[model samples]
Target: MEESIPTCTAFAGHKKIAAGPVVEVAGKVKRYQDKNPDAQILIFDDSSSQQVELDLRGTVADVLSRIPGNQDPDQEKSGPGRPRLGVVSREIGLLPRHWDWLALQPGGASVTLRKLVEEARKQNRSKDAMRQSQNAAYKFMSAMAGDLPHFEEATRAFFAKNRSLFETLTAGWPKDIRDHALKVGELAFHDDKSANP
Candidate 1:
C-alpha cells in the first residue's frame, strides 16, 4: 500500500480563516474561507502522488520567474512593463513576448490550444485591419511609400507572411501621412491607367 502523499492548498481574498495573501486551502484540519466573491469553485489536481505546498505569498509572478525560458509555455518575451494579459501568459506557463494583450478565448471554440492560437490569430487579423484604418490622412505615403504595396502584395500572396506588424507600425501614423498617401494613390492609379490605355 502507498503512503498518503502530503498536500497543501492556498487561499486568497478571505483572511478571516487563512493567514497571508495565500493561506492554506488544504492542510491541517483548519476551517478556511473560500476567497472567490462569487463563491466560484477553485479546483486543483487532487493527485495523491504529488506533494503540494501552500505558498500564500507567491503571486503568479513568483511561480513564473522560476520556470526556465525553454520550459515556459509562452513563445513571447517575458519582461517588465508587460500588459494585463501577461498574467494569463504566466498562468499558462508562458512568458510575454510577441503579443502585448493576451486573452484566452476558446479555441475555434475548442479545448485544444492550437484552436486557441487560431482564434488569437483570427482576432489579431481583424484588430490589425481596424488599426490600419486608424491612420492619419497626410504623410501616409511617406511612411507607407516603401511598405504598403509590398504589404498588400505579400498579404494577398500569404496572409501568414504578415500579421499584426503592419498595423502596429502604422496604427499611430501621423495625420500628414494619410493625406500624402491619398495623393500618392491617385498618382499611381492615374499612371497605371495611362500606361495600360
Candidate 2:
C-alpha cells in the first residue's frame, strides 16, 4: 500500500501563503502568524477545499503532532490480517442472489467484491475526478471569492462546463484566488466524449 500525504493550502487574506503537505503548510502558517498575528488566515484541504482549523498555539513540532495521520507509519503497530495491504474488514449486506453469484467466483466473495469495486472505479475514474474537481472549486470559490466580481456568473459557467466563459468571468478576481480556482477546477472541464448532453 502506498502512503498518501494530505495536502493543504493557506491564504493570508486573499494571497496564498503556503501549499503542500499539511505539515509543511502548518509550519509556514505558524511562521506567518508569528510575524503577522492580526492577518486573516484560512487553510483549506486540497482534496475537498474545505476550511481546516489548525492549532497554531504552540511550537511547530507541537502543531504538527496535533495533525491527524502525522505519525510515522512504520512506528505504528499493525493489526490483524494483511496489515501491509492496508485492508480492513467491514460488514456489507447483499441479497441472496448477489451472494450466490459472488460465491461462484474463483477467489470467493471478498476477492470477487474487490475485483468488482476496482473495475467500477477504473470505469468511473474520469467522471469521478471531474465531479470532485468541480466540487472542490465550488467550495473554494464560495468561501474565498464570494464577493468578487462576476462570481455568480462564473459559478453558472462552471457547472455548465463552459470553460471559456468561466475563465472570462473569473479573470477580474484577485490573482491568487483566480489562479487557485482555475488550477483546482481544471479537471472539471475535461472534454469526455461520452459525457451526457
- What's each prediction's TM-score? 0.17, 0.82
Q: What's the C-alpha lDDT at position 114 in model 1?
A: 54
Q: Across residues 1-197, which tens digit of lDDT does each residue of candidate 2 receive?
A: 35477788999999999999988999999999999999999998987899989999888888888776677777766776566676877778999999999999999998999899989977887787788888999999999999999999999999998999999998889899999998888888876644322
**lDDT digits (tens) for residues 75-107 of candidate 1:** 556565343343332334545542322444433
* Candidate maximizing TM-score: 2
Report the error of model 1 at residue 103, Å.
19
The alpha-carbon lDDT assigned to residue 155 of candidate 2 equals: 98
In candidate 2, position 194 carries an lDDT of: 41
